[model samples]
Target chain A: MANPTAALIIIGNEVLSGRTRDANLQFLATELGALGIPLREVRVIPDIEDTIVATVNELRARFTHVFTTGGIGPTHDDITSECIAKAFGVPWEVHAGAHAKMAAYYAAQGTEFNAARLRMATMPRGVVLIENEATVAPGFSMENVHVMAGVPRIMQAMFRALAPKLERGAPVVSATVHADGVFEGQIAEPLAAVQRRHPALDVGSYPYFRPGPVRGGVALVAKGTDAADVAAAADEIEALLVAAGGQAIRGEPRLDDNTTAKV
Target chain B: MANPTAALIIIGNEVLSGRTRDANLQFLATELGALGIPLREVRVIPDIEDTIVATVNELRARFTHVFTTGGIGPTHDDITSECIAKAFGVPWEVHAGAHAKMAAYYAAQGTEFNAARLRMATMPRGVVLIENEATVAPGFSMENVHVMAGVPRIMQAMFRALAPKLERGAPVVSATVHADGVFEGQIAEPLAAVQRRHPALDVGSYPYFRPGPVRGGVALVAKGTDAADVAAAADEIEALLVAAGGQAIRGEPRLDDNTTAKV
Candidate 1:
């Protein structure tokens, strides 16, 4: 069976404005892959209500799980919670658990649990709160959609808290073969033939450039649910690279380990 | 008047699989923003033909310009060119200019311009070629949609070639106020008030955490077309931070210059 699919909606103007480079997607991708969930799509959208509502609705319907980050803060630009509520056609209200937690946490800190801070507690009806140990404001899971904070540390914590509830599939296994002094264009045909032999595996060719004695090379990766199939494909790729008069390393070549003589 | 909007479609399975992190979006976002084009949306979709075609069509219709990176290689997974051709309902064919360029480039390096290598020359009908100085394979521009390579250096070159052809709008001006020892939750309300006063400007509050004695702080950014308005809003934010019993720096605080005592 195919792995469960997921879609990540990164909601923020900061990312779109090029002011902030998104760090959440890579973390989520790696985590979800380990959990046997294939993240199929990721949309980095601005802090716009209509766009958020539409994107959330579309992704939630298509993928098995949908995760959102950013725009759930105490500021005016934070409109993700309300947009999510609108998407589900539910009334946006303050959850009792979230409210109590935030209020108590702020009281303990001797900081005012002002109206703006309290806004973080708001969520759609029938939502389960995702714990945020990094911060007081809790993220929530509404059906298959997990709404989390944009902050990297906070988002990681929330995902960890919510991960146990998700349905996992067969974990994907991957193997890489790095070919020294091999141009992707030169080896593309042989690589494609190997991929054709292993129809079940996902084969990818990524070229890398370095500023050293060995200037460039290609990394061939084979990914699939079946370990044997992935290994077989990697073996085939290694054989192909050797036939093409190139030295194929078993794994990714470290930049410092560029001892292979250039062809 | 608002600037022309653009959307970026990042086509690759490697990124979604956590095998590779995307670097194209940030470069495009910064470049487009400087050219007075707001990068409103960015979608990282897999190298699936139907998904690519549908996404390209949707983004092309909605935004003034659309840019796509990845999947334009000599490998089996490189289906972006064909998908783009299908999106525009045009025949996918080898461009004479691209074919000649690749053939000559490979011949110069004493490499055979094989069938798989020639695949990079395939593009949609009526497309203008975007030069790739880093590599021989040329990216193309079909109407407002610019299709480029996935490699950062190659993509950068293609974007630079295409930038001169785009409709440039008024560049956005920005100002920042860094508040030392100020919590985002504490200053959310005041920041909102400042945002309200300058409705035309885009105001954002981003919290930062440091490992040293000065633990936390907030960076208030005011962005807009009007320089004077941005400066005025930034000044107001500085005053508000100072009133809240914190030190407000005019620009982003360099960590080495953080001599200000913690509150």
Candidate 2:
């Protein structure tokens, strides 16, 4: 069976302005991959209403799940909730449960539940709240679209809470075979042949350059839902590397394992 | 005048699979922003030919410029060049100049110029080369779409070489005002008013949470092509912060810079 597919949208002007680097996509990608949902696409866009609304609608229609991070704060730039509501053609209003939670939380902290803070309670009608134990405001799920905060800690917390609720498919298993001093060009044809042999698996070759002892090398990875297939393909890759006059390591090498490289 | 817009396509499975964190997007964003070109959108997609071809065609048609990184290596997964050629409906073949360069580079390194290595010389018809001083294989440009390597060092080198050839717009200037211990909710309305006052500037508010000494804070940034306008809006934001009973700092805090935030 094919794994469920997902798309991620990262919304923030800070990221587009190069003032901040996004950390959410990779974290989500790793988690979703483990849950048997393949992330097909990820887009980093600025916090603009038209762009956000269009992107949200497009992704939600294309992928089984769409996760959006950023622009859920209590500030002028925090327009994600409203844009999402607009995309679904739903009325934007403050959810009573979310409002009550934020109010109670702020009261306990001795902070006033001001109008600006109250904006966090706003969402599209009929959306369930995504829990945020790390922060006061909570993310919400409207259909397949999940909106979460941009902060790393808050985003992580929301994702952890939301992951269990999502539907799972067959989890992808991966195996890596590392070869030292093996130029990718020298073994490309054999790698292609190996890939052709296992048409169901995704075989990828990544080259890495290191200074001093380990000049450079390539890592061949085989990934599939079937662990046996992935392992078998990995073995074939190892054999191919050995036949090419290079030593193939069984697994990914640690940084300290550079001493095993043949100069 | 509005700046020329650009879109970026990150092509790799390692990034989508979460094995490798992407380092090219931010570098491109910063460089594009400084050169007065706004990076409007960035999409990270897997190393699939159909996806690459469709994405390349869509982006090249929509944006003034498109930059793609990854999958331009000498391996089975390196299909970006052929996919790009297919997208343009042009025939793909080995460029004599590129082939000569790669052959000479390999000869100097005492390596045979194998068929796989020769793949690096392949490109779409009527395309110009983007030099890669860090590596032997040169990237290529077919009209507005610029294809480069996935490695950070090589990508940077290619971008540096290509930047001077692109048309430059008016550079954006920015000013930031940091307010410590200021809850964003307390000043959201005032910030919105300030934003309304300067329609040309891009006003953004980013919240920060620190331990021990500083509990939480927010940075209000004003960006625009006009320096004086950006500075004026920043000053107004600082005044608004002080009016809301918060200690406003002129510049962003040092050291407390959240390095843990993902890039």
For all candidates, the clash counts are 0, 0
TM-score of chain B as predicted in candidate 2: 0.95
Q: Is the docking of candidate 1 incorrect, acceptable, medium or high quality?
A: acceptable
Candidate 1: clashing pairs of residues: none
Candidate 2 lDDT tens digits, A172-232: 8899998778878888999999899999998998887667675877788998889999988
TM-score of each: 0.95, 0.96
DockQ of each: 0.47, 0.51
Top-DockQ structure, candidate number: 2
Mark the regions of model 2 whose C-alpha exceeds 4 Å error after superposition: A254-263, B255-263
Encode model 2's per-residue lDDT on B57-172: one tens digit a residue.
Answer: 98999888999999888888999999999999999999999988888887887888888888889899989999856777889899999999888888898999999999888988
Per-model chain B TM-scores are 0.94, 0.95
